[model samples]
Target: MAHQTPDLIVSRRYLRLDCLCLLLLMLSACSSSDQIEQQSRTVASASQTVLMALDAWAAGAAPTAYTVDTLQSIGKTLADTGAQIRSAETSEPTEQASLTKAVNDLSVAVTRAEAGLQADDRLKVQDAQQDLRLASRALATAYAKYFAPKP
Candidate 1:
């Protein structure tokens, strides 16, 4: 067999190194994708919980207009959901910020409604309800935009 040139031996080593690097990069990308998917699923589940709580409150099932306990329960749910959104590990910082803001706003609105219930103020509770609904819609839009599949 002919002797291999020094340059050829170096080129072969470089090719192998490149192949190994490419495989490692591919594996890292897959891991990152899996992490993102898990984060999205967690956010989705929290969003669903908040939405269900909002629906119940809006349907008069919580007696927010009269009972303090129901108002507290709804407020707690909103706050918990907001906390979850804030703590979620999302790849997109801007989207995460917007979602956190929307969720926090809803939580604050619910707290205001709870205060209104405690004070027996119908107008205050109604206004807070409207704010909560608007916040919820904003959050839903953000969630859809962030989690939608790429084209």
Candidate 2:
């Protein structure tokens, strides 16, 4: 039987250390990729939601306008909700609550906007249309924040 020298044992230890380092690096890379993919999926889902709302509006399936105060309130809510979604990208809490708020606010806004369809208030309808467009744009912005690849 041949006896192994001390140098050989030290060399084996070094090799083990290198392998451990490589494994850690690979794990880090995988985690980063998962984060990016998750962000992309979130953005895509949000886009789909916005598109559905817009389609419903275009098809005359929803209200034409809302009471002035309701419109303003919903618009403001949508705006704030959008900001929160974007902020989630960098915020420590991940802004889950904010994203939920955005979805709920958008739902309410759609309801209010669609409620005015039978009133025949063209000007108010137009205003609601503008607000809806603004809300969609805000959603797009928030989506972009998550989906856009790092520069």
Candidates' C-alpha lDDT: 0.66, 0.52
What is the Cα-based lDDT of residue 131 in candidate 2?
59
Worst 10 residues of 1 by lDDT: 39-48
Steric clash pairs (candidate 1) = none
lDDT (10s digit) by residue, model 1, range 76-149? 66566566656655466777777778767876776776677677677887787788778767877776776677
lDDT of 2: 0.52
Give all candidate RMSDs, comma-separated: 5.4, 8.5
Give, for candidate 2, the lowest lDDT window spanning 10 residues. 89-98
lDDT of each residue in 1-151, candidate 2, tens digit only:
2888999989999999999998987776566445644643554354345445545655676543433344444445545544544444342233344344445545555555545544555555556556555555554555455445655
* Candidate 1 local lDDT, residue 101: 81
Model 2 segments more than 4 A misplaced: 63-151
